[model samples]
Target: MVSAWETWVRRLVTRRPGVPAPAVAEATDPAGTRLVGAPEPVSRLLVVRPDTVALLTAAGTDPQLRRPGDLLVPPLLSPGAPPVTARAVSTAAVDLDVTVTDLLTFDGHAVDRAVLGVLVQLDDRDWYAELLELAAGHADDLEEYLLAAVHRELTTAVRGAVRMNRLADLQRLTLAAVLQDRWLPARLGAGTLRCLRTRVQRVRWPGEDEPTVPVRPPPAPAAPEPPPQPTGPDQSVPAGST
Candidate 1:
């Protein structure tokens, strides 16, 4: 079973000698760049490394990748074009989609609920709830399933909050998402700072104490105009006079 993946990796390495290899090969080619530093290679098998999974995700969608049996490879860059550099990409920025057929092709790695959920959440894609339920029932790593669900909720809330311009909600959602990251629990608190900074910067607020407009006393109510004295024949005579 393992031999199949090793064979595929070797084929990919041979197919594109200088192209960035996606996974750490069990055997290294003297000519190829190391896998750890370059673009992640896609595979018919599930990739367990979260970072590698993330890199493949950042590549957006390729029509070839969506085909059931198509071998995954790094995108061929245009002449003088640069490859993507962002680590954590927002799905909104890309026009990518994954079909259920493509997803079910994961073979033994199909139980990776985290990767599955990512396929669903990114680019507003959704899997039938029954599909996820089925996956969860058989998933080898239940923790990854739950974590994926958490991240999906976070992305949904964050996007919704941003759309509505709800800063407080956005802050709450971002903090909740950060807390879900077990690797850096401190980021939960720090995440708030980042959220506030981003919000202020996004709206172009220059200072913490800056007012929306110059504060000044409101104009006093104008004194009521004095009643007009009688004019001509309409003038009232002196009280004692006729």
Candidate 2:
């Protein structure tokens, strides 16, 4: 049966094939190495000495590292081995002390003897100090790029929100105006007629030469005449009545 340690090493190697086994050692070593932090996909490995910390790339090589600190230190495998240290004098070169520790610590992952065996086979090379300078500059550029991208996203969202709000407001105002117009009465001219008039009066037109004539009122009907007084009763009454 495969040991648990072997299985773990296999899994780690499979997950990140680009990461050399030695790099893993440097990452796991507690005394020799420490994980400063991982900013997303990039992991920063700090190689420490008695005095200062030397920053290494996530890939374990410092191509753009500063001068006098150009040497690459091999990973620690044995508990009894000496400790590893590095000194950077300029941007182009570096000096390092190599040591061994019984155990290493990295990002909470532990690597022991079996795992260290697979790591020591990897090689190390000196990286030019100018490479570190280039990397430093590139890091700044990346930050600016990311900041601009975030700004653009925020601006777009704000604009869309504003446009939607404006449309809703306009709709509300239009609805209000329509309701107001429907309920209000229309205005009328000064000479409009009413239905209850009992008379029709006519006035002469302006600038006419004819004298003004008064309109005549309809004549009152003559009072009904009273019947002729009855003839004296002495006279013989005629058969036909008047």
Candidate 3:
């Protein structure tokens, strides 16, 4: 019987209006476990027996799907399979939904339950019971697995926090630049300063403590000298000392 995951992939292929079905490749780790690869343009599906489903990414470089312990296992599974469940973990965009078909094709039927549980938790959906069951089944490695899971959680959280901080910093810088550009001092002079007329009332200067000296305009030019006072007819002003 075709696995539920496989069935989902077929449905996805039909639903997409113009996109063509992706090519499937078989990926084998040194240990010889086989996983189906859903290459770019095609979503990969992973089938965990009984009741787990996951979609693996098919874009850009394929993501490695393995648990911490997998490192100890010779020939780690590469491009292992879709996680039964996955969380956004960290994303630069809005929430993204992984289609059932995509999940089934990314990894085909060789995922560890513990890893799947981590995915489910990250997904933050209604798979708590399944997550518990997976955890219960792997009691031996429960502690270690949980630790790794928490590490992934913290890693994602830190990345998100950093991104948020950077965004806030950019916003603040933009506001400061805009304000400085719009409100910079227009002119400065000895004891007097001028700003845009709109901001005249709002301008503040450093030496407000010192009284402002009233600016006096130069005395108007002395009324043009009355044509030489007709002194000649009145009192003869001696050119030489009289």
Candidate 4:
């Protein structure tokens, strides 16, 4: 009988004929080769060095980058490898030491602020709509307020007209007072007659003469000039005296 260890070893070694061999594992350096000599405490803005030209050239020629603004997620380089390749573009190259972290931070902040502003504006509009709806819902309150305002204005106007003596006795009726009494005509009979009398007094026939007041007659025309004082010389004896 086969031993357990032997059976296990046989099973591990056996393979299907059509199957391919497993891929070999390789050691990798995370830090790019070009940045191996880069200074510690890396700055936000790092200038491209001349030595990384080969890396940048390779990146520019990458087949995967077919469009503008496309980004290489993880750089295509090993530890100590230069990242010049990743920054290459068709028009102009980025010459700074911007890391993925920096890019994320910048984009995140901008997106957050824009989203927040839009949300705030929407919230304000919603609040305004709600307020309008509430006002509409309580229409009775609004009507009361409007009616009070109108009444107050009418009262003030009536008082002012009366004080200024600009109102006829009939016109002086206060709307508020009339409303309080259900708008009944004050003098269904006598008051109506008085109103009719007032109306009649205001009427006048076309071309009717108005009462005329005495006007002083214009001064009589000045006496006609004395027949031109004998034109040539002053014949009057007074001329010699003067």
Candidate 5:
């Protein structure tokens, strides 16, 4: 196999204004800059926006590094440029669709039909740490990482509630009632993702246009079984004599 990374010096990747402002973004096209601080030979550099932080895996020694005001010597990790992870201090809204199922009952209820709409906010403070935890030392992709975690949390909460109660209760239950005080402030690893808005978007029951079919009305009540019963006994005996 052939290698493409030529390790000679360090580089920087900065988030300029007016670009796609994702909370955490990969620095694919890093901009080259003068060695900011220590003469550490890094494969690449990521200079994030104000109030934003970048995780430079292939650079400087101090683990408690904050910014480039003090550029120290960077370690030389040679083969290729390690991908830089940077996140601006901001919040992002993520919408999740979680399937609510009746776990305790074998009611043949749909496992996929009923869904709860979960609107969560990934704030500036917590998202990065949570991302790092979920990444588990792997490459970083914020959207992919976040949604997976959220979906898991939502499913757990919903199913837990469903197990205690019937699906019928869920049909009438409102997402707002559960979300604000109950499901909000979810702690996933070190990340804090809160439920911003939620709703029970779908249920397995019939819709307005397709309501419960009415029973056939007991065949119109048999047309008044009236006073004929009073004389019917004698009338039948007389017929036999004739």
Candidate 6:
């Protein structure tokens, strides 16, 4: 089980099986993901991890997305694991920690680039059917598929807002407002992965500052512990007192 996680984790850190490593941030190379719906026929038993949910499908049945830490094995003395038809995929954490870099956005007349990062988590129950279908492409692993699908979502959302608004509007932080206003009510889940937070990493044009969306702030840092009181009492005698 440990080995399984180790192997998967290492792959998650890189772009692909034998590609040169890219500048990975919180999540390996989410922006660098190239494949989504690739063949992942499961033969041996698989132990799922906390960071991801597993997608599986057998003959004559609908595809299912299994939760994290789930063990995929035949029930006691079955022939073997069932066939997985569609390309498999994995789910990220519950907390919003996913990020994507470098996206192209349109501002009515001109096209601009805004490096966007988002924090997201998997929607355990409902994300199964819809998400897998959206991530149809070519990828060896599930995480790559997930990242690619998410990238598409963020890209679409940003582009849509930028297109309607003007450069002046974005400078006034309207882009952030538009995303929240529209996506929030509809539940921005590109492929069922819910949007938790968003940050403007940077913008192509000069003098354009990143804007903050309305979201929960990071937890306050824990207070420092005070120096321990002298233990075992008067062994060291109070200063100038007896």
**Clashing residue pairs in candidate 1 (N, C-alpha, C atoms within 3 angstroms):** 22-40, 22-41
Candidate 5 per-residue lDDT over residues 1-242, each given as its tens digit: 21221111101111122323332224322322111111122334434433333334333321222332223223344345343323332244444555554434224343334466655554445434554454344223333334445555665665555445444554556433544446544554236455666677665553324346787655555676566545444545555585
lDDT of each: 0.28, 0.27, 0.26, 0.24, 0.41, 0.49
TM-score of each: 0.17, 0.18, 0.17, 0.14, 0.45, 0.48
Best by lDDT: 6
lDDT of 6: 0.49
31-70 per-residue lDDT for model 1 (tens digits): 3322222323433232232222222232233211121122
Q: Kindly report which residue stretches of model 3 are placed more than 4 angstroms away from their true locations once superposed.
A: 1-128, 167-242
lDDT tens digits, residues 1-242, model 6?
Answer: 33565354333223323321121111233333322223444544655544455555566555566655566664333655455533324344222222333433354445446555455555545556665564343223455445545555666676667666777767777556666777532334444666666666556554445666889889999999998887775677668996
* Shift in Å, residue 44, candidate 2: 13
TM-score leader: 6
Error of 3 at 190 (Å): 70
Task: Find the 10 residues in a row with the least total lDDT in model 5.
Answer: 6-15
Distance from true location, Cα of 3 in model 5, Å: 24
lDDT for position 22 in model 1 = 33
When 3 and 4 are scored with lDDT, the better candidate is 3
Off by over 4 Å in 6: 1-42, 74-77, 80-90, 94-111, 126-149, 181-190, 206-242
Write candidate 2's Cα lDDT for 66-160 as tens digits: 22223344435334434333322111111111111122222222212111111111011234233244334343232222223222332233233
State the lDDT at 97 in candidate 4: 15
Ranking by lDDT: 6, 5, 1, 2, 3, 4
Span of ten consecutive residues with least summed lDDT in model 4? 113-122
RMSD for each model, in Å, please?
22.0, 42.7, 28.8, 41.6, 20.0, 14.9
Better of 2 and 6 by lDDT: 6
Span of 10 residues, lowest total lDDT, candidate 6:
18-27
